[model samples]
Target: MTDPFFLCTLLWFALSIAALARLRRRDRQAIQAQIRQVGQLADETNELILFLDYSAPGFKEIDAFLLTDMPGRVTVVFHAPQWLFAAKAKRWERHCVVSADCLNASSSGMTPTRVVLDKGGKYRVFYEVPAFLKLWSRSKM
Candidate 1:
């Protein structure tokens, strides 16, 4: 009786491991397929894109930037790099200001960017808000 019980337990354990391995492989394939689709969409739209792997070990969301969900795990895409800075500012409860010189330097990848917060006049700014709310408010009286 004891021998039979032990044999059954061992068999069950082995089967569980095998099933887990199969599920992992399937999940990986699904994630890969979704990533390919996202890449295609981004290319078609000609927009700057960023992909965040939430399922990956040691994964951390970027300090700023909004993520759009397509399925398995999560993929994040930003309209522009400047949006990232704006998002960060929003998170920090601060305002984001961009100057032509700083923007040019950062985007051009020609020189190191220096952070300057001085009392100045008008400058470019960016902010984040719920798209639905924005559209809804615009439509309302």
Candidate 2:
């Protein structure tokens, strides 16, 4: 008879893959939800929308919202995600920072021109990206 160990190991591997696939699908759906929400608010004009949360290190889950849907007319940058005072949030934050390069125009010396305070102690930074950079950023992204 064939060794049961081999069958058991194959079953374990299949289960692992299924679990991972489920997680990936969930994550993809979450990201799509984010994109859809902001996409509804975007217009086919020369306008920039900045998003953030109502807690410390806001812009917590949303880094940049880049939408190639409308191309130059409307571009969205979903800067990944950010931390939210929890372990999962911390991982999300790291993801945003690392993935935001597409639309994140900020440099070491740059700073926001205005700060918008939400209900909580958290805050949002509103920086006006240059007109030239908008096109360049969108095109490259």
Candidate 3:
């Protein structure tokens, strides 16, 4: 009968819609679970140390940049605050430029200074007298 055919088509359409909805829901939940796992790991790490090259635009391809800027390579150790533990680490590097500069200057030694960076954009600079300072001073006299 025509009624049976119409009923079958309608049922098939309803089942397809339900299946698509279930797949979407599962996908969303899987994404959320991944996010939570990353957050947990970030919390445990406390701090992240990233070696960077100041000559380059950003922290892309560590080996290539290191080879090009071998003389000017720097190590950036980022300390994520407790509050920002849940925040992703990748975003911080992109948004923060001052931190990068501090790291660059510390390693380059063009300036005899060391910088300490903390959360909320706070930093301190300390002068590091070269190890041979006393000897050099004696030689000057």
Best by lDDT: 2
> In model 3, which residue pairs have backbone atoms overlapping below 3 Å?
none
TM agreement with the true structure for every prediction = 0.34, 0.36, 0.32
Candidate 3 Cα misplacement greater than 4 A, ranges: 44-92, 95-141
Which lDDT tens digits does candidate 2 get at residues 22-45?
Answer: 976664454444334444444222
Tens digit per residue, CA lDDT, model 3, 12-50: 999999999997666445433432343343342211123
Order of candidates by lDDT, top first?
A: 2, 3, 1
Give the lDDT of residue 54 in candidate 2: 31
Off by over 4 Å in 1: 44-61, 65-141
Q: In candidate 3, where is summed lDDT lowest over 10 consecutive residues? A: 97-106
Per-residue lDDT of 13 in model 3: 100
- Model 2 residue runs over 4 Å out of place are 44-141
Candidate 1 local lDDT, 1-141, one digit each (tens): 469989999999999999999976664454344334544543432112232222322223232223222111212332235655465435433222221222111222211211111113211111222332233234542
Q: What C-alpha RMSD separates each model from the true structure?
A: 18.8, 15.6, 20.5
lDDT against the true structure, each candidate: 0.34, 0.38, 0.35
Model 1 — which ten-residue stretch has the worst lDDT? 110-119
